[model samples]
Target: MSKTHFPLPVRQLAVFLSLLFSGYLLSCTASEAQSDTPPLNPNGDSELALLMRAMFDDAQAMKQQIKEGKTPRPSLDYEKILTAEATEPDKAASDTYKVHALSYLQTIKALQQADAAQAASLYENMVNSCMGCHKALCPGPTMRIKKLY
Candidate 1:
């Protein structure tokens, strides 16, 4: 015996398409979310200090990688620190804080792209961004940001 298949109803097809579209959107959002680094704590002294130290450490490591002609390992800890900072409670100026972290990440990406001069330029901007944030949120790190150069 032969079997016949019927076409799906238009409403069902629309629903399926809607679900597929939603899934696609969500996947894109998830990937973007994964790429973002969290903000550092704007208030915790120890946490801010640690993150500031990590930022310098990561910068040094990136420099060392360039000097040794090796690919730098990504700093996963920095991302976590930034995430925590970005999500901290009572963050009235969180948007500005996030901009600083993002600037540093952008500079790092430029460094990874192999343009030494452009990367160097971005490095100063990155330091500036950090300084700008630290000046208000964690003043103690102002000197540390200067040392990163």
Candidate 2:
């Protein structure tokens, strides 16, 4: 059999690309779980919960489009929904909760700029951010958020 060799630079590029692909796959899988709709809020629907429920629906639509190899346009109301104050107050005014919420916004910005190649991954990251916040501030919805992945 003839010996085959790849040049050092070419091999390096291959390695880098492989690592990037692996990371993307891991990110996708890590968030992959069956997302179920959150149980109705016991205290009745708060404005924040309503906004999140709407956002989840929009995200699912975007995910479906991505799975179909289509580019998704960001929802026009996303920013407005995100920035609106919760009609019901959080249990506490903790910085950690605020950070997670901010991360969601930043992830949305990333999704807004995503191309076809990047949209799915960005969407996964955004979902993960939602899960992270819920884990801290409202563990009840964690499983539901996981399904978004």
Candidate 3:
């Protein structure tokens, strides 16, 4: 028999990355709120609708876990927002979306790093970023996203 094992941190990073990707897929598939015809934005990228639903699903799950007094492990792959082909290429390249997305990402990072007492407020700010972006680009999902809080 041959046996090989990765170092602890490497293994942990692998598991975390796996969870981040799987969370996206699971979130998409598990969401019952998704409509058959996704609401496309002005740029006409319907693919982003599914991604948004997946994110919403993930956010809902995280909020639920926190409400249950559990520290939900961070599962976002910030790189996906940068690289995902489903998004509008031009919008991805836009400084406006990038700034809003970065704020959301930073809030998530803060929540991930925060102690329990601070997580709730950080989570609210994270959701606020979602609202801010939606208000500017895709207002249709604003109410749905707001419910994540």
Candidate 4:
């Protein structure tokens, strides 16, 4: 039998290199999996948070349709915005939040009925109501919601 032995330093270097390469690969994988979707709340997402994400996705599609001079379709039953559970119950249960939620629904209804020409204006109003509610209850989302415009 013939045996070939690597020097101790050479073996240690190989181990270190293997670990370094593994770390780099893992980091790349993690970065690739990252998405534009917002991170979940520390306490996990509430029903309202998930609905808002669906709303945002729908709004993006609607905005594209509007840009192409097509009518924006409302796919979500948005009345849930008023009753959906919130990550923070204290904030969502407030009278102010209720008012904002109602106003948002009104704007959404108006936008849904808008003609092609009026869709843009009504859409803007709808987005404004969203921002307004965010501003009143949680300002963190106002910036993200602005991208809807």
> Which prediction has the highest lDDT against the true structure?
4
Candidate 3 accuracy as lDDT: 0.75
Error of 2 at 60 (Å): 0.7
Model 2, stretches more than 4 Å misplaced? 1-39, 80-88
> How well is each residue in 56-106 modelled by candidate 4, as lDDT tens digits?
999888899899999999899899987899999888899999999999899
* TM-score of every candidate: 0.49, 0.65, 0.63, 0.72
Cα lDDT of model 1 by residue, 127-148, tens digit: 6666776776667657756776
- Candidate 3 lDDT tens digits, 106-127: 8878878977677777778878
Q: Give lDDT tens digits, candidate 2, residues 1-149.
A: 22488878888999999999999998787666335445475566766767888888888888898999888766846555445556446543467766887788898899988899999999889899888888887887777777778
What's the residue-level lDDT of 54 in candidate 1?
71
The RMSD of every model to the true structure, in order and in angstroms, is 16.4, 21.0, 21.6, 7.3
Relative to the true structure, how large is the alpha-carbon lDDT of every model? 0.63, 0.77, 0.75, 0.89
Over 4 Å off, model 4: 1-39
**Error in Å for residue 133 of model 3:** 1.1
For candidate 2, what is the total of clashing residue pairs?
A: 2
Better of 1 and 4 by TM-score: 4
**What residue runs in model 3 are displaced by over 4 Å at the alpha carbon?**
1-47
- As for candidate 1, its clashing pairs are 38-82, 38-83, 39-82, 39-83, 39-85, 39-86, 40-85
Error of 1 at 63 (Å): 4.2
